[model samples]
Target: MPPLNYGTFFANFNLEMIRPFFKERIAFRRKAPRRMPSLAFTTLPSLLLLGSFTFFLAPPARARLTFHPTIYEEKADYLDTQTVAVYHFRNEGDKTVTIRKVRASCGCTVPQLDKRVYLPGETGVLRAFFAFGSRSGKQEKKIRIWTNEKDLKKPYELILRTEIPRAVRFSPIFLHWGRGDTPITRTVNAWVEADSPVKILSIDEPAPDFSVRLQVLKPGRGYLILVTPRDTAKPKMRRIDIQTDFPRKKPLSYSIYCSIR
Candidate 1:
């Protein structure tokens, strides 16, 4: 201060000017620590919102289904005078379903399905009855089922076939004939209602013990045939041939086979 040094004076003045800047920097550094907790709290809410949004956006799981007897009635066969039953079809789908109808390719096969609606994981039954009474050898039949399922577009089919023996079958076909041992005497007794006029042209017997007689109750209207067997006649099989004079149905034949002791 006594020598009045100008360079030293200017340096001292610059140091005083920079000292306020240092103080301000230190104050800002001290305030940074207080801001850390507020910054942390603000970021936590944003992170929680992001996590909730991600969870809700995920896709849902898919439903599943199962079917019982997906392929059924693999094989079915029968013989003459044999009654065949087809195994029932069962469903195990995840959703409810209904069976609309059941049908057969031929009159020989009769099919019946459960008419009630089936619920999820429920089962239904289908029965097929085959009558081989008059059916002869080498026959093939089909049973079709219609259902209300989203997956199935057309009716499902079950196939049945058989190699039948060459034998004659009677119209009064059953386990036990409704009538007793007494033979049918009148043609009217053996007649059945028919849409077209049926006439018996001729009768034949394969075995000596078996015999047949015919009469026309009404011309071009109806007729009756009498089937008789001798007391000592032990016939293994019997057959009868009927000829109709009508051209619509040229000829119709009826036959029967039975075991006599």
Candidate 2:
């Protein structure tokens, strides 16, 4: 920046190595000391370097694979377990293309490709596996695909959308034990298949006339409840509110009715 001193910059080079251009630049600057020095000498050296970096910045190349459901968005009434959503894609290009790798947004989601390479017009399936262990509500996931497409440095993002419902199904919400019949324990099973493992947090407090116990077939997902009337002698009504860990608006509760007839 301080006027490039040839003696300091080109000190290592021998005097005989000096080009005619450097001599011409020195003579021209000497003659016009009052005028601004031309930076043309520096521009010429830059041109020589530009030859090494002459890659033309161009548009992004075309993709070889075309997906059937380009964007996967589906609503599930209930996603009880880890689910895999598959996307069908074909090599639309005339040439073969290799899939280098497939990645997902999170560890909970994984992308699976059958093979590395695919021939032209060959169909391939991309399976996106989503694990919803204890999560509920609307879930959105993304999968990034890397391929051998020319000039394609950035990966393609595939979007996935799912809606998980608050899933707790009770076979019979209402139970009755007749007065004349011998009192026997009645069972109600609460089956839950959900991203969030559901377990009964607690049952509503003290119903003196009723006896209730819970049985867990599968830790969080499946539950069996035993409800018995203390004595089926008189008419008695007990309100059994079942609470679960499943995500819900408030209280996170399911209701069951118990009555003595």
Candidate 3:
């Protein structure tokens, strides 16, 4: 993925609008060399016009909002079910600003604010809750803020970054063994981070040709499961499922593949 250059958007906008104004000013300056005193008198009107144009292009300081930190970062553990991220901003402008709407990029992130409007010199905090249902690893989210700041054409973008450490993971979910050959044993390793603790409920029932044995390295979370061929005399195939105590409404049962030929 490519990094986003947010400044380019506004830079292009300002350049396009100011180009014509500068073009006319340059033409007047070139003609002034031909007539000194008459051009001197004539340039006053152009100078006034230039000043007025500058005033029109000046940034609106009367309707501005200042964010303390535009981006919020969170370092979270893999087992964390939910976490709250907060951002603080102040209405630095002299005029009151009304928040038209606040939107988030992901459904798992929800933004909460007290009201829709903010008085001048008032401060507002945005609380966004990130629900880590079954997600892991580094995640980035976006929040768009729309306000009645007349000068702004688009909503301001705020970034939310969350880093979730992968605490638990399974090696290979699928395994196979050749049939009519020497019955060999296959192994499945369940690794858990030293910080996070979890318990293994059971290895769900396997196929008739495959038998399983579970060994615990750590009392609660770590385990080594051995799978052996019960009868490899003929061709057979089986899909073995394993169960755990992980709390997920979505039935996220782990599985393995076994085949003999």
Candidate 4:
């Protein structure tokens, strides 16, 4: 016998089952006063065969790697000089995948992975270490990842978001005096922005031409620094350091600028 054509067989089978309905429809139309169109009924068999052939020849599904959460958020305390962010993911496709590279947005963030290759249905974790150093306020880091999967045109990006607390927030960190100007005392306001209590340990002595003093406004919650120039006849510049008891290893320090022209 000749080779069997599945598409033709299916089309012929369906047409046999639907032939009774088609005959009834035609008989009813013939008895009616007006004649209905027959183009759709005539072309339906060809369309059905084409659809069946296309469906049988379709391509297989591609592999896909998915993450539980693409974005992560956290709140960092003042004592935490460094923080780690974790991203959990798994291969959900039939093919195995290999992570070619992981790139971080900045040098302050380092990405780490246990291995490069992962089999189908395997799980993995991507960790990023962010060094706060002297950074404060809201911070965000982006990580781009590459894989051996071909279906994906662009690399996947993961976001790391954090809010770092400030030990003390200072306003007007700099004070200046113009030449021949009157020597007046200026005040710098300091507000405790950390969750824990932070006290002003001491204020270092400024240059001989400038004097500095610290006063408590709300105990550990707030304070004020008073700076004055003994004489503004000569130009002078100085940086006054304010010590705090945040942490020994990563102590928090505040500084203010003073200058006379």
Candidate 2 pairs with clashing backbones? 80-193, 80-194, 134-196
Query: What's the TM-score of each model vs. the native?
Result: 0.37, 0.43, 0.56, 0.63
Clashing pairs in 3: 179-261
Q: Per-residue CA lDDT of candidate 2, range 17-107, in tens?
A: 7688799999988898585657797777788678655544444467878887857776665425566788999998899999988888889
User: Where's the lowest-lDDT run of ten residues in candidate 1?
Assistant: 169-178
Sequence-dependent TM-score of model 1: 0.37
User: Candidate 4, which segments miss by more than 4 Å at Cα?
Assistant: 1-63, 173-187, 195-197, 206-210, 228-239, 246-251, 256-261
Off by over 4 Å in 3: 1-36, 39-41, 44-63, 171-189, 195-201, 206-261
lDDT of 1 by residue, 11-116 (tens): 7785777998999999999888653568678899999999999899976433222333333332323222554555554555577667777788888778775565
Candidate with the greatest TM-score versus the true structure: 4
Scored by lDDT, model 3 comes in at 0.78
84-164 per-residue lDDT for model 4 (tens digits): 999999989888899999999989999999998999899999999999976789999999999998887889899999999
- Clashing residue pairs in candidate 1 (N, C-alpha, C atoms within 3 angstroms): 187-224, 187-225, 201-243
Total clashing pairs in model 1:
3
lDDT of 4 at 113: 94
Number of colliding residue pairs in each model: 3, 3, 1, 0
Candidate 2 segments exceeding 4 Å error:
1-60, 167-261
Q: 70, model 1: CA deviation in Å?
A: 8.1
Arrange candidates by TM-score, highest first: which order? 4, 3, 2, 1
